[model samples]
Target: MNFYAIKAIYLFEMSRTFRTITQSLLAPVISTILYFVVFGSAIGSKIQTIEGISYGVFIVPGLVMLSVLMQSITNASFAIYFPKFIGTINELLSAPVSTLDIIIGYIGAAATKSFSIGILILLTAHLFVPLNIIHPFYMISFLLLTCFTFCLFGFIIGLWAKNFEQLNLVPMLIITPLVFLGGSFYSISMLPLFWQKLSMFNPVVYLISGFRWTFFNVSDFSFTISLIATISFATLCLIIIFYMFKTSYKIRT
Candidate 1:
């Protein structure tokens, strides 16, 4: 409803992204290139393909997902956390903006950054390996969903965090590890049966698996289950965000 308020917050966050171009964009681009170099050259040699796709190409979806997830969280979390850290959140709170406006502004900007990096990375992947999208619609659907979901999740992290260190905690310690173990570099099928069973417990696996399927029509789990898991997780994040705003959890403190 408050279009101007949303636009102002969105543009402000976008400007901040441009200001930190090196860290926000270039850093992830460089890191993804390194991953391609190391994994594509070294591991890709021993393993030519997984699920009938070349090892280098097979990992592209997962790599993009990994970068997008981390970027979304990092950007959104830092964007809000900085304002809170510097005591400017109160300014926004006092403004004529609804919680919906604020969340949409921040979350939209964060998702845009994350998704932009993801598209760039996808283009960058073409340089290292030939790629194809068997299902463009499915691919974009999953891409948008993942970007929006994680960005919202990151917004929640921003609200819950009390300091810079805490802002970095989940992405560094939890999300990143989940992604690596979630079949970013290799398929879960390559794991031992016991480890395979355990891998099912990791939620990131479903996301990566489902996204990978859109590319090669291959997945570690059922496509339906992956879709369900992703929607379920996003729903949970949305619920938490509503509760946080309604109760003023950490927002008024």
Candidate 2:
């Protein structure tokens, strides 16, 4: 099914990342190390623990999730958006490739980048505190699904964007805030009852909660709910991408 075409696009996108490794990889690594320093060292020493896990270790999942979410969006959005911005998108569109091949190429590369960052952050996290992964299978599952889902979400943003400002809009304004408020740094149970109830409305909460569960076996929501939520979100993204390609949304422009 046009495997060579898909490989060509995928490798090209990946090569761009290597070319910009300092910006694409090192930046996130340095930022995460800073988070580890400030939150894990300074604050963690004062707080001691959350739900019986050391605060440093407890924050690992959230920290990784934060970076994954941001990078997934940033990478995918920029990859597709740059083509649109520079008028190369029309060339790709007219090429002998199916929509699925194009999506697999772009989103696959983006997902791989985000996935690498996730694993990198995980290894970096170990320098600050000893960590335990209670459920390794579930942890990888959550990470894989999260990378793919958010990469697809970023693809949608890339397609819908009309300018650089519009391109950065969702990841900066919407996603980052949702993650902060979504119990990324703290447990929802620490919130008052009202805020706890309200937090459920934020979809990022389930993602962080479920990922956290795999690490320490502690969660704000049921693991089943988190699994279901992630699957549903990915499915929804797939549907929307298909519709956009079918309608040539923004691409025909």
lDDT of 2 by residue, 1-253 (tens): 7899989999999999899888887887888899989988888789978899888888899999999999998889899999999999988988998889988999999999999999988988888778889999999989999999999999999999999999999998999999999998899999999999999999999999999999999999999999999999999999999999989999885
- How large an RMSD does model 2 have? 0.9
lDDT of every model, 2 decimals = 0.90, 0.93
**What TM-scores do the predictions have?**
0.97, 0.98
Per-candidate total of colliding backbone pairs: 0, 0
Q: Residue 205 error for model 2, in Å?
A: 0.5
- Of candidate 2, the 10-residue stretch with the lowest lDDT total is 20-29
RMSD of each: 1.1, 0.9
Name the runs in model 2 displaced over 4 angstroms: none
Provide the lDDT at 103 for model 1.
82
Q: Candidate 1, residue 27: CA error in Å?
A: 1.2
On lDDT, the candidate that comes out on top is 2
Clashing pairs in 2: none
* Index of the highest-TM-score prediction: 2
Error of model 2, residue 60, in angstroms:
0.4
